[model samples]
Target chain A: MMDKEKIKFTDEELVARFQQGDERAYIELVKRYKDRLLNFVYRYLNSFEQSEDVVQDTLMKLYTSAHMYREIAKFSTWIFTIAANLAKSELRRLKRRRVVSIHTMGYDDSEYEIPSEDFDPEKETTSNYGEKQIQEAIDTLPDQFKTVIILREVQQLSYEEISQILGISIGTVKSRINRGRLRLQKLLKDLKVR
Target chain B: MDCYSFDKVISDYIESNLSAKQKQEANEHLAQCPACSEKLADMSQLLGALRTLPRPVTRPDFESRLMARIERQKQQKESPFIHVFHEYSRVISVAAAVLLFVATSLFVYTSVVLPGSPASVPSASIRSVEPAAALPAAAAGVRPEQAGGVAEKTLPDTNRVQNPDYNSRIMMVNE
Candidate 1:
């Protein structure tokens, strides 16, 4: 019965309750956001395992930093901001490790294999092919464009929400999304021709 | 509208964010320009694909794992003071209240109640006798023990200086 009542509360209200040390409210917030965060982080990182870790870290941050949330912004915006920052940090860390590994690889190291960035679209068929191509196209975009694209298109967040999450003006968000879509369009066309 | 101008506003047109005049210009450009029309169509398709991308779900144990981590965090966050306080908060609070009550009672007894008590009467009387003790014994021709009474009796004349007699009395004392 109490669970149903909790369900009726809005995300902001749930966060408010969590701020006041209500454990159930925190659980409800987690339940509400876990899948959404996973989707966002997965699109950003492109690895299920890593994305899961990022989402977990994001939630852990939420748990520890609930007091930092202000009612000035929507709870979703704040949580997504946290998830996006973590995902970006993880991406940078991965890139650093990749660079280090490449530099450290010895010519005689038989176990070392350089990872391939190529995706074989021939292996994907029909609906899967389109999705794969779109994902690859998205991956080709710069981080600024990719973030706005995913937030606007995949997560269907508002311009204002994306702006708040990315800490940019709404005009910048709009421009980035427009340019990102244009870039994706060009990339998908190129991929199709190939 | 030229292809360059249309390109700049195409996204806004697709989102219906353009002003009426600008949107109309875009519509006219799209109608005439096959390349721009195709571009718009492709963008629309891309948006659709993006919106329909498969959402991944976390593992079934995700919540349980997260909860366990939260529990661990909660435990870790408890400093020694917080831990001890949490364990014995009621007793500590009660003891604190009792201590505060005793301290307050002591303060009131000393500051407000004690001053009016019979135990303070002797000190009050001693304070009152201080002025009498300050009177000169030689001036009153009395010993220190009898000075209080004699000083009270001679109080009026002490203020009136009978110069010669006072000088003679002082000489007698010296003698």
Candidate 2:
């Protein structure tokens, strides 16, 4: 999905160029993964505005920490690690604010719009509700389970790649996704209640 | 696969990501049991639906906003915020050290050790420039008066230096 006119650079090329202070490569990188990274964070926190803010912070981190990247891992994997850390930190800050008993700083998950026409795009008419139930069940799962499940099922990353991003063992990633899926099945079990 | 084993295999089966032996076992089980096959169908469909879910379109200002924010941050980092503070403190410290060294050296030179100057320049006045400037003149003028006083007071004392007897070996050499 990369543009052919531009030099066919690997993620590593873009990273190396970025480290050498080439804004073009960084721009290319931002163009490449901005939406994907934003979606991951958005789905994780379930807030578009907050995810946008995180994506900005993530790119800033990439720009600043470019030299800290290693050659062994994929550039996307390295970047997602930073995004995940920021997501973790932001989540912590929001939770602390919530505990003060003030009005919530971030909106609750109900405000999250799944980026799909799978739901009826037309507000005038409603279609099958089964899919909506599945989405809701997924939303109900805890953050850890949800992260693993989304990375595996939605992002379609390999277990090894997910492990590197999350900085957990592959075993843990598998267990978490397994647990997350089972939890979803449980939550959606009575949908067509046998 | 047994029902208990079926749970574990369900994920691998839905992903179509099982080992060969696991795949054979799952196929055997799915051929017999409708329940797991139904679950597998549902799970695979769910996964397929999720994978098909589109990534949200980034807002129009996304790149510019990110660039602006990152530029601000890079400027902050490049501004030498902490580095400037540290260097300023170092400059202040070195200046203080040099001042202290000069002050201490001046104190040792003007006080404590010079024998005749302790009389000519009062300790407190030596701290000021006037007494310091007067010291050489005072010593030069006093030398003559002392010479006359010595001639009148003790002619014999002149023999001590003029006498060949004291330091006679060196005095004879001078003579």
Candidate 3:
């Protein structure tokens, strides 16, 4: 019998409990972070399936490397750093496995296509294309701007935390967010004009 | 404040990052300039929309699925010591092969390649100093002093000097 109230602890407290071998604390941490991380990674990688995989790897790292977690940084920052690195590595791998353009071959081929099984065609069709347009606009952003936007807007993390996770200065984080939002604004305006 | 300065810090102003003086300057510029004001409105709206974008949902069983995967991972993991060994297993195997090769080469050189006889040793020079007169009739002919001459005559090549007398002396000593 576990107390539901214990789940209300801050992430740092829960991580401390987890380091002390409290499995329930680990579950609580997962419950608190999984959705936010999934969204952040999905926006970064643009594939729901790979985002889920990256999140899973990040959590597993937390579990196995609990002893390595220090109290100096926010747990969210540390976890996001892991997830960001994993996402970047996955992106690099996808780059290496370049998908041959459909124009290259006479016939449509799915074998060399990277499988994104979690993509929901039905949902894409239902939203009157607002969500899809926004997603596409976001997709057009360079990796740095895309990451800054996702972390700032989606995760709602503070500039300091983002700077720590990105290993950049706070000034850099702020400027990047400003530039990203400006780019997003321009993209959205263009989309609306059409 | 002119439009140029206000435009540069509009984002900071919108996000409340501007100081009081900078904020006042931006406000004065926005009051008179319709273009700057409209731009500010659009930028704020854009920021609002971005903030309001729906958060993507995780599957309902996300936690259970993750926990199951974690359990599998834990079970599959090797023990710490074994894991360390497994990580360096390639290097360890390569080093072992190199060491075995060196030891084998040394053994072959000492036992089969360098010595003329199995009984010949590091102290072969001491044995060679023994008088041929003290030798048995069979081994007397195989004097150490004549060894170089017999070897040179029979086989000039360095590797082919298998002295028959040395082998016979070794066999006799063994018997």
Candidate 4:
């Protein structure tokens, strides 16, 4: 049997139209990916505004790379791969500029203000210290553990997807996730996790 | 706590990341063991916390500004090599008209050419060069029958069936 195309017309047809100078298809693509890419980029940059810039830059890259878009993976994975790389590069740029991670460090996670009615079997504090304490603890983790944790927890990606995206063996992915969780537990040792 | 040999499998068991066989073995171990159960509970709690960390929201106007910049930057980043390739495709039909001219042409060249088909498939024949030392010395200590020949100018080249010189050489050797 002929291989049913992994990529539908919705995917390639939109890209092909963009290549053929249909700026409107580009618009549709931007609309489709903008928010999703923003979320991916936001993970890298603590600032929402900077993530917006990253998303823009990533889209421009995708448009020009339209012809290069071979349907090798789920478009979501491919696009997020680009977005993540861009976000990382942007992070590096800020590092070069010496924008101290004080933003990352001295976070007023007052915004994480959990509407404190209580949603759990155990009532946990929604204090800023808890967010900072958790962030500091996560930030201290080795980059390998840190990345897997963020991808699995924050991005809510599957272990298989994390394995493919990070180019690690599945065992390594599982190990890192396990190790990261253990570390996070150690960081929030006082918190009731159950 | 009873120290178990399969502590390495703890993470695997807690996550249910183990294969069915591994899970069965781990469960078997846990059924009789309480230490493993406590460890499993702790690990499960940690895993639950990690999976439940709140997903944050993206700042507004995040999409539109990104789209606008990508559009403008898209043109500057447009690859010139792609255009050159597309243009080169059009030049092919021009070849049908240009080759129609055959004026008197004296093509001069100086090169020793080794003639062979350009498209010929390659094959290699390996001929072994055996040294005379490799010839086995038989019972009389001269040489074996199978690898008999140790080529000498004095010895008759009797292997050549068509050569008349073979009979003279054989007679001289016999006498």
Best by DockQ: 1
Better of 1 and 4 by lDDT: 1
lDDT of each: 0.79, 0.70, 0.74, 0.59
- Superposition TM-score, candidate 1 onto the true structure: 0.67
- Model 3: per-residue lDDT, tens digit, A157-189? 889999999999999998898888778877877
Question: How much does candidate 3 score in TM-score?
Answer: 0.65
Model 3, range B1-175, lDDT digits (tens) per residue?
A: 8877776687799889899988888888889999889878887766665566555667677778888988766655746666667779999999999999999988877776665554344344234332343344326576433443222223233323445365445434433
| Model 2 CAPRI rating | incorrect
lDDT score for residue B117 of model 2? 46
DockQ of 3: 0.17
| TM-scores, chain B, all models | 0.44, 0.40, 0.43, 0.34
RMSD of each: 16.9, 12.9, 9.1, 24.3
Residue B126 of candidate 3: its Cα lDDT? 32
Indicate the docking level reached by candidate 4.
incorrect
Clashes in predicted model 4 = 0
Give the candidate number with the greatest lDDT: 1
Ordering by lDDT: 1, 3, 2, 4
Docking class of 1: incorrect
Worst 10 residues of 1 chain B by lDDT: B151-160
Cα lDDT of model 2 by residue, B120-157, tens digit: 34333223223333344456776423423222122233
